[model samples]
Target: MLRIVLLFLALGWNPVAGAAEMGDDGLHKEDWFSITFRDVAEDIVAAKGEGKRLVIIFEQRGCIYCREMHEKLLADPEVRDFIKANFKVVQYNMFGDEEVTDLDGEMLTEKTAARKWGYVFTPTIVFLPEEAPQHVSVRDAAVATMPGAFGKWTFLNMFRWVHEKGYQKDEHFQTYHARVIQEMRAAGRLDAE
Candidate 1:
């Protein structure tokens, strides 16, 4: 299948610069934290059982942002540490052969699942419970969706925003964004400020 070929191609790729391998803590280190996905459903189920959040990073073969997340953002030591401690990460080829049970109770191809969830772009990360309601289906977002690439500081702020359940209070990213910026200033990323 096309996806099979693409997966092989991705695995074969070398960044040329040979970025450091990220560890379980989401830190760029000398170990491999990247997992080759086998069974998504089972892994998510276990991850939830263990009280780990599920961060499903959906990406395509040719997406540069996806590569950056893999090579830069995710490869960063801080991010890697946070991810390892807080989440069970999974990667899927947007058009791969993986069959995911979407927000709705329908089983769909990874490609169709992405479309059904209405993510029309590459590198959408979905945060959700392990099992969604039967009626939710593949066509709807089963959980929270973050689209596009955000730099390190912004993404970390976003993580804190979610961690504090800020969205449930205001449902406004800008509100949380400002609050996080203030908090960051208090912590004295003065140079960043």
Candidate 2:
């Protein structure tokens, strides 16, 4: 256990404060929402034919916030189902050696894609049209890039906000968040196990 503690510290996992959620079926309760985590370029190429947008989440092992969101926040049944149904999910390590083709059709390493795409932090979720450039904003103009693990509500709200084009007028995420919260409450899905 001492070794594990030291490892977590080296990897930078802060102590989590929220209550861990339990699934109704007595499992950790991850949703069926799955994203592809490799060869993003390839996936984008495929999406061009199908006209699908992609949400890529950059995650590193041992990241405290990433663990919190994936383990605590996304453990909720609702969020999982929402993501699985809406996005093409992908998760990748920051310092990995996987190969991915770039938009230019150049073959490069995953690390190169991170640097080229300006992935500066752990748990950075990049939203882009499947065939769009990284700099081309999908729905959120200023913050097409999000860094770090946010609360469950905010994270989940992002999917709906951007998908529905709510960023056109709002300057910040709070308004959209408030609206989503109201909707969630209305549906009585906030406390969904």
> Best TM-score goes to which candidate?
1
**Error in Å for residue 163 of model 1:** 3.1
Task: Please state the error at residue 113 of candidate 2 in Å.
Answer: 1.4
> For residues 136-161, what per-residue lDDT tens digits would candidate 2 score against the true structure?
32223223567887777788778767
Q: What are the C-alpha RMSDs, in order, of all predicted structures?
A: 9.8, 10.1
True-vs-predicted CA distance for residue 180, candidate 1, Å: 1.3
Clashing residue pairs in candidate 2 (N, C-alpha, C atoms within 3 angstroms): 33-84, 35-89, 35-90, 36-89, 36-90
- What is candidate 1's CA lDDT for residue 4? 80
Q: Count of backbone clashes for each model?
A: 12, 5
Which predicted model would earn the best lDDT?
1
Write candidate 1's Cα lDDT for 44-81 as tens digits: 57676766766677776667777677677766778677
Per-model TM-score, in order, reads 0.71, 0.65
**Candidate 1 lDDT score at position 127:** 65
Give the alpha-carbon lDDT of every model. Answer: 0.62, 0.61
